[model samples]
Target: MTEDTAAGNTEAPANPQVKMRVLGQFIRDMSFENVMAQKGIAGDVQPEISVQVNLDAKKRPVEHQFEVSIKLKLTSKAKGMEDVLFLCEIDYCGLFHVEGVPEDQLHPFLLIECPRMLFPFLRRIVSDITRDGGFPPVNLDSIDFVALYRNELMRRQAEQANKTEA
Candidate 1:
């Protein structure tokens, strides 16, 4: 019998201790538009707001380092009105030191864990920008990074399957 079998170590090796640290965090880009602020809209107006969140990650040439960014796009339009009230878009990025994570698990770690670490600051930025633009603060709902990552993987797999069929 193999040494592992003899030792009853049939299970996979224990996961390495993954370490992550935030080296830097900053707003890469941001814009807020108060479209109707100058038009004197009624005080009772209630605008419908929609926010989209996206996450992306890239490894740097340096070992155990990665850059993760979260992008948010917010659109606000008054009820029963076709014109937009405001549009806000921001790209927030963080430099991270990730170590002891396996290569196979790196993508998920970057897309899920790293962004999870960076999301709160990004959300606050969106909220503050909207408030500073003379509107009520737009508090972004908490994001489900795991769900987002799964959905992205499914989409990519479907696209690849379609390409292969073609």
Candidate 2:
């Protein structure tokens, strides 16, 4: 028997080691609009708000590194009025070192896990920006990363299936 095999270290040495880390976090873009400011609007009426969140990840050419970013868009319309109370959009990003994750599991890890780590910061930024824009802080609810990942996978699969059938 080979000495290495006898020692039971059968795995290949070059197999990427599994590790995850956050290297940095920063706001890549930010925009805030207070449409009603010109009208000298006051806080007499509560506004209806809508928010959208999107996540994207890209692998760096360097080994075991990735950039994960979350894009948040929020719009508040003055209730019972035609004016837009405020609009805020932010693209927040984080640098991550992820290694050893298997190819099959890597996509989910990047989309789900990496964002999971960066969410609180992104959420805080949204709230602060909204508050600074002269409206009540819009507190974002917790996101469902697993659901988002699964939905994205399903969408891709459906798209592929359509392409194949057509």
Candidate 3:
């Protein structure tokens, strides 16, 4: 083997390393409706809410680097209301580096670690948005990345199976 290859094989390869560099952060988009929440607070109104979370990651040309983002949407409405009381969306991201690691290890880091790192920031934003809207702070529960990843994998598998069957 060539010296360079030999060196790489001998010592851990200088894996491409990625470090999240927060370029810029802003409220990409946000909306809050306190009027609905206020109306629902009393017995006259009953409140119902639905929340959806989505995770996505992309690799940058920067070697061993990736951008992982989480998007959340929350909708709150009254029992029989056609109107929404609260509708909010949050998009948060973080950069990560992966070097000297196998693909198996890197996969989890991108899917799990990157999101975990971004969660606190995303959570804070959600809390602030609700608080500013005159409602109690909405604190999101910690997520289990492993479980989330597994579910995603299963969902994709099922979808692929359906496609093949069809």
Find the candidate with the highest TM-score and give its number: 1
lDDT of 3 at 20: 45
The residue-level lDDT of candidate 2 at 104 comes to 90
lDDT by residue (42-96, candidate 1, tens digit) is: 5767889988888889988988889999988999998888878899999999999
C-alpha lDDT of all candidate models, in order: 0.89, 0.89, 0.75
Q: lDDT tens string, model 3, 1-166?
A: 8897877756765766654445434445566667675556554555577888888888889887777878788887777876666777777777666565567777777788778777888888898998888666788888888899889999999999999999
Report the error of model 1 at residue 14, Å.
4.8
Q: For candidate 2, lDDT tens digit of each residue in 27-55?
A: 99999998879668866777898888889
User: 2 or 3: which has the higher TM-score?
Assistant: 2
Candidate 1 segments exceeding 4 Å error? 1-14, 38-42
TM-score of each candidate structure, all chains considered together: 0.87, 0.84, 0.73
Error of 1 at 102 (Å): 1.0
